[model samples]
Target: MAEKGGIHVDSARELFPRVAEVPFDAEYKFMATFHNMTDEQGKPVVRCCVKGAPDVLIARAGYYWLPGRDPAAVTDENRKLALAENDRMAAAGERVMVVARRDFDPTTFDPKGNLLDLVQDLTLLAMVGIVDPPRAEAKDAIARCHSAGIQVRMITGDHAVTAAAIGHELGIEGQALTGAQFAAIPDEQLKPQLDQIGVVARVTPEDKIRLVTMLQQKDNIVAMTGDGVNDAPALKKADIGVAMGITGTEVSKGAAVMILTDDNFATIVKAVEYGRNIYNNLFNFVRFQMGQLVAYITCYLLAAFFFVLGGVPFAALVILFLNFLISVPVAMALGFDKPTSGLMDKKPRPLKQPLLSTSQWVRIAFLGILMAIATVYLEAIYEEAGVTTAATMGFVAFALLSISRGLSARSETETAFDRDIIHDRNQMFLYSMALLITILATELGFLQRLLGLTSLSGDQWRICIAAAIALLLVDEVIKVFLRSRLHDVKAPVT
Candidate 1:
């Protein structure tokens, strides 16, 4: 925006394209870029002028540009009109800049000195409105975050009206607070209301850092996003620092933990979804392995206590077949389990929460006992054939039952017969291979000799397979009970 002797030009770049083409000398060309400053005597206006050029100074400010100028040119009616226009543009989610110009003598101008005194009696130029609309997917992303129990906020150096307008459009709820108001309030008062503030306007770098610190003190997980050099401190102080790859300065990028290459808010939502999926996958893997260990230990100890004819429950090679051949492959396959439905609908887990929750522990205990009992029952039924034969029956029964447990581990609440597993072809194929390998190891003549196992008769095989199916059925029943109980239950984060 440009003006000369009361004549206004809307397109400044088009009017002086050649003058704008010169390579920028960053230090002196753009002086007093407004961000978090109150000049001497508490004035908010800032002046910027091109170095080594004509003595024309361009000033940008909010509503404060009405003072220290010619009252005849900027009459009361014009001042009211300008302020109204500024509010109109700001409330429409456009950044409003009040531009005014003043010419000085070039020979007497000092680039390093204060230019606030030189802006007196300025010619009121145009009140230009700039629109930097949010990305198309940003609103949807913010909605997703809210559904996931995540709070999003906007901290900008724009006018409070502009920030509030943008916050409302993005579905962020809360009142807007300016930097001056924030500084006036004590931290004790602000902490309780921090969650209720959706936008913070005209904040300095120090104010941003303080805001992050306040949120962290309340156990809130703060993810700060920025693209400026002044944002480095706050970015580093945040729990997750997101940098705009397209427009971010090098300092901001270096301070951030994650960089948005596309500079889209939707990407952050997708990242959260994938991150939760990975965390769930890890939890399931650990639970699967631990539950299998409990099953094996309980079975061994029960056998040793009930039947005394054995030096060992199973041979050394047989132990290897149970773990490496059957358990490890299925455990690894559990890592590929997709996120369960409504994964993001749950609240975030607490920072101090344990890896295994209490509910998870209870489920593991119940399922592990059921599996052990099934394996021991098979051994008891076949014991008269001798300890070796009983051991062989127990090994095969344990391996098959363990595979069923792996299937159930794919979901915390969903049963084995649920559509979750039925629709996951990759898991089904991998599990089928594990069962096939276990059966081949026992039935093939050379393999049976290598594994130190006795060949099972058709009747014995029937009992073992029935035992495996019984374990699966019982676990599925328990899951049905859990689903009913936990349907409306909220996940505990503390």
Candidate 2:
């Protein structure tokens, strides 16, 4: 990291009597200063000035300081030995690199004349290998991903043998392919086999982009993780681009939609769980609101038709008051619903699937029409008694049906009284409060007048209450039928 005593050399033209400092890639920096003494001992040495493959000192400049004259540092013999050593260590899953620095003459080498410019004559110092074992929890995380029907792949610019060795150690099983092999494969030929190729090694940035594009064409939702300028294109191309905040280049981070502060792979699993829940919650809100809207329109039209009224029973302000005090609050509370069991056990939802299907819309229509019929039937009975109570009772039924909708919204399979609903205290409270407020508003004299409604007699109130209860009863019966239908639909055949 530092050179205090040695005269700096610029290339082989001017050599330092002894070179002191080198880059992080110079793994022998610690077993160093013996640098010169060790060089005399013939330690697999090669000369490096400022250029070559920037291995461990990736993306950095001026970090390397070498001082030698010979440009033939990488002779055929040296390359052979280096490759042999790299293979040996890599077979043991070690990341291996050869360190090289330059020898310099002490008097002529400039200590301060632009370190990068002057330190040109490079020398091969030593070959150092490091083993960065995966984290203890990484295997477990991968296992969880597999269980949840997710696939994990490793793509790197590392050597094929080294990458494969590491993949095996990490319990990753897949056919190995180099970037060149991938590039050579025709797109049509590659589609079916793409899922089998796990470890892609010696890949350039273009290879990564091609992989992402190919995966997308196969209708796979690809989430690409990267942390370099070269990674920007593929990251942008992915369905979800994740960047490592700590180590990612600005270009890559800008292209990515999600940035991982800790850069932990397991964090992605957690994110997926939350993302699915957020979407489910949004759907629940939509399902509830849309159903309520449909039911209100149905019930309002039926009552108006039965009573021969030209206009709606409720005023515009009444609708707003009811929505504010009832619907919105309850919907907001539904957002807090706990994630269902085995949230991560399911495969990823289809990207093409809509939030609601046609069948769900039909169910909504049925629920709405039922509420309308119940309300209209009650309105007719009250009007027949000459009590002038049908209109007020119709409004009550509307509020009541809206309140009961939460139960249906919570589950498609589970009934209102099922364990999933009964055990959820938040949901129970939300349901209770919505029902209580709606009932209270209809009964309260001041609120009823404010809503432009006449007060109902006690007996008439009982009738409205009975009719409202029927809507829930009808809903429960429908739920039971629906549950049975679902069971039959899902039943495995012999």
Of the candidates shown, which would achieve the greatest TM-score relative to the real structure? Answer: 1
Once fitted onto the true fold, the runs of candidate 2 whose alpha carbons sit more than 4 angstroms away are: 1-46, 49-93, 98-129, 165-172, 308-315, 385-388, 418-429, 452-494
How much is the lDDT of residue 228 in candidate 2? Answer: 79
Best by lDDT: 1
TM-score of 1: 0.84
Q: How do the residues 284-392 of candidate 1 rate in per-residue lDDT, one tens digit apiece? A: 8999988988887887787788763362566778878789978987887789887788888878999889999897888787788788877787678677887767777
Residue-wise C-alpha lDDT for candidate 2, range 1-494, written one tens digit per residue: 12333534353224323344334221211121212222454543223333223232222222232345423435556555556766788778776654445555444545444445434434454455668888877777777777777888888766677788988877677998877898899999998998898899778888998999998998889999998777889999999999999999999999999999998888888888788777777777888788778777876787567553333645677678777888876787667787866667667767798878998888778877876676666666666554335656766766776776765566565566557767778877887888777767767788777775566677866776676667667767877888799679769998
lDDT of 1 at 425: 84
**Regions more than 4 Å wrong, model 1:** 1-72, 75-77, 116-120, 308-311, 420-423, 490-494
Evaluate all candidate structures by whole-model CA lDDT and list the values in order: 0.75, 0.68
> If scored against the real structure, what TM-score would every candidate get?
0.84, 0.73
Give the distance in Å from residue 148's predicted Cα in candidate 1 to where it truly belongs: 0.7
